[model samples]
Target: MGMEFVDLFNQWASSYDDTVAGKDPEYREVFEGYEEMLERLANLSKSPVMEFGVGTANLTRKMIEQNKVVLGVEPSSEMRRIAKVKCPEAAIYDGNFLEYPSLLTPIRSIISSFAFHHLTSDEKREALQKFREHLEDDGEVIFIDTLFKDEAHKQALIQDAEKQGFLNLARDLQEEYYPYLEDIKEIFVEEAFEVTFEQLNKYAWLIQARKGE
Candidate 1:
């Protein structure tokens, strides 16, 4: 991530929780079932996990409630600050998906939520490679984010957002680096990971990928 994104997130940190909680009318559908999605992701993940883009530590809190050891990586200082207060048991660091402090031991799982779209396809692949390096041989990667079934599905969403007069949502859909399902599956396969996807809501999907034996 770049300084621009960091600044954007820094600015958003204060109200991110509210936005995700469906307080933002325009983004309500996008964040529908927010609590359920976090619970599902936390349940799927294993202990000694490393979570990227741990915004406000919502997911971190869930994992901690499950007695999972979590290391949170976040680029925004403000987000990290809030996350620390919310999830004091977890270690929250100042870093992005692609670059973070190295772990002394391989983690059992690598996880994230809603934040993976910040990276482009190439960057996603690069981050996956790094994740492979940091994970145990049998570790898994779990992420919940907005992903399209295909190019057409993505376009339809953008058009729908525009029709709803959700200009900000429409612009975000157009500007972000959200990936196609098939493309992400191919990338995971190429990296020797077995992956699966389940739609959690109209906008988000749960991706569960495991390292190949």
Candidate 2:
């Protein structure tokens, strides 16, 4: 199932930046917030940073401007090609976060936007453990993605989408792997990571967590 998306995104990589933003005006607003969050994270740290699933290098470009030593882990070759064009100085690697070499030690911050859902709950926990190992003692992990409180909340979102005359979007939502909020919190707690969450919308949020002492 996940491999399917890799191929799909690879095919879409060429025109991804323009099409995704041009398809809807709302996406532009979401991307603005996404960029804002990345900029804030960049300002928070002067150390090395890593971005997981860096599609088209949207945030990578921002980190480059902040002068942070940035590395990007991207699964799709086509996407990495685009990311290179977008941020040539960034060290883009060909792998997912779970399989990343972890050669960069004491990484100050590891971040992902709208890409964490590619992992299942168990996979998410596994990836988080790997991220923790690669991070500095007080390093942070930030995720901005589709997040919901529970199944009921997800259903409510579907209903809201239908009310807005977006049945196709609702259908897509039903099949998506939006991470459950409490489940992610449990992983953070179990991993001894201090966590904070900021809601971006009814269906998306930004989560910032740090390894606890």
Q: Compute the lDDT for candidate 1.
A: 0.90
> Per-candidate TM vs. native?
0.96, 0.88
Q: Work out candidate 1's RMSD over C-alphas.
A: 1.1
Candidate 2 lDDT over 1-213, as tens digits, reads: 144469877987887677545455434433455546656656664458888888899888887898888888999999998899878889999889578765736788888777887777777888888888888988999878787788898888788777877775687577756777898889888888899888875556888899886
**Candidate 1's TM-score:** 0.96
lDDT of 2 at 162: 77
Candidate 2: segments with Cα more than 4 A from true spot: 1-4, 19-22, 25-32, 163-168
In the range 1-213, model 1's lDDT, one tens digit per residue, is: 434588889899999999999999889999999998998889989989999999899999999999888888999999999999998889998888888897888899999998888898888888889888888989999999999999899999999999989999999888888888998899999988999999988899989899985
Which pairs clash inside model 2? Answer: none
